[model samples]
Target: MSIDGNLLTLSQWLSPAFPVGAFTYSHGLEAAIEAGWVHDVVSLQNWLETVLDQGSGRSDAIWIRSAMSDDANLSDLDTLARAYLPAAERLREAERQGAAFVKTVNAVWYTSFPDLLLPLAVGAAAQRQRMDGDAVVALYLNAFIGNLVSAAQRLMPLGQTPAQQVVSAMTPLCLRLTVATRGASPDDLWSNAFLSDIAAMKHETLQPRLFQS
Candidate 1:
């Protein structure tokens, strides 16, 4: 694909309209809102900033780039991704979305690859197409964080404008991680956003929940 074509493909894959069912998972922002940890735009931004910087968001970026590498062992990578999930709901969220992504992309893009973890599936697909690695990882995080912000709108009083503003502020962090993770490997993956991880586990038992995780 040409540069323009690659850009278009990335946009479609990461777009809100993509059939990955991303909107249904909040990464536990729903539960966080109930606990008063993420009750407003600023708090929400802080929560997500930590996620992108020190949580699964950063970890997923590394996995994506790892899957894109020439010598990637996808089965091992997928297994590792599953092993690191902090909660059962988090595991379900990643598995279902990753499966849907692989099924759709295989039928639409005309290829065959086993269903893998979400980040790994995306990375392998991007590698197959020779897509830009930076764009792939950046936009994947963009969509991931953006979906959570959208979920926050329903879980809290955050309006569309404020929600988008949060996404805008988060854009730089996403881009910076893409650049930083260009040479990253899964061995370097880490998740220290304890609050986010705890929130994801908490969501498993949250009453009157509006999100899956």
Candidate 2:
């Protein structure tokens, strides 16, 4: 495929219209809202930046790059990815979205992705399709952050303009994280967004919730 072709494929796969059911998960933003940790655009951006920099976002990027490599351990990587998810709902979020992504890719593109975590599945597919590894990481991170931003929008009275502004402002951080972690292996994967993890775990028990996790 040409560069344009790869870019188009990445755009389509990462778009919200893709059947990953990503909107159903908050990545723990709901619990944060309940705790008053994120109520407006500034706070939301701050929380999301932390997640992007030190949470599953960074860890997933590392896994994606590793999986795209020639000799990735899909099985071991799968186990580690599952263990890396701190909460039960977090694990479910990754597994369910990953399964959906694999199913869609295999059905539509005739691709064969191992039944793995979301990041790993994406990495495997991108590798098979000959997509640029850095581009894959960047687009995946954007999608991840966009989903959480959408979640925040629904959870609060945040307006569309501010929400979009936040997303636009995050572009540099996303690109920087992608470049910084481009060469990372699974051994380098670690998460420091403990508050986000706890929010996700607590989300499992929140009543009248709009999201699954």
Candidate 3:
């Protein structure tokens, strides 16, 4: 594929219009909001930045690089991703979305690699489509962060203006994360967001939840 083609594919994957159901999972943002850790726009923004920096931005990006480089043991990576998810609901959410992404990509394109976790599938698809690793990483991070922001907007009373601001604020973080993940290894894929994980676990039993995790 040409560079333009790769970029276009990345755009499609990053778009909210994609049918992978990424918008359904808040990655614990909903639970956080419900717990009052994120009540307003500023707090929400801070919470999201922390998540990006400490959790998904670092861990997922590391996994993405590993998947793209073919340095990841698929079974081990899958197991770790599953086990690392502290909540059953969160685990199911990732697997379900990952499966959906795999199926959708396979239906549209031919690839030897399937059964990838969400980040792995995205990185592999980006590589197969000939996207540069940096661009691929950036797109994945952007999409992930954007989806969370959208979820926040729904879960909270955040207006469009604040949501857009949140998205804008995340751009540099995504770039930095992409750079940091460029040569990251599977061993680097770890997170310390215990509270987020606990909240997700608790969310499984929370009454009247707005998100799947």
* Candidate 2 structure quality by residue, lDDT tens digits, 1-213: 445789999999999999999999998999999999998888999999999998988998998998899888788889988887899999999999999999999999987766788999999999899899989999899999989999998899888899899999889999998899977997787788999999999999999899998
Best by lDDT: 2
Clashing pairs in 3: none
RMSD of each: 1.5, 1.4, 2.0
For model 3, give the 10-residue run with minimal summed lDDT. Answer: 66-75
C-alpha TM-scores of all predictions: 0.96, 0.97, 0.93
Report the CA-based lDDT of candidate 2 relative to the real structure. 0.91
Q: Tell how far residue 203 is off in model 3, in angstroms.
A: 0.9
* Model 1 C-alpha lDDT per residue in residues 106-164, reported as the tens digit of each score: 99999898998788899999999998898898889988888988888888888889999
- Candidate 1's clash total is 1
Q: lDDT score of model 1?
A: 0.89
Could you tell me the lDDT of residue 47 within candidate 3? 80
What C-alpha lDDT values do all the predictions have?
A: 0.89, 0.91, 0.80
lDDT at residue 36 of model 2 (Cα atoms): 99
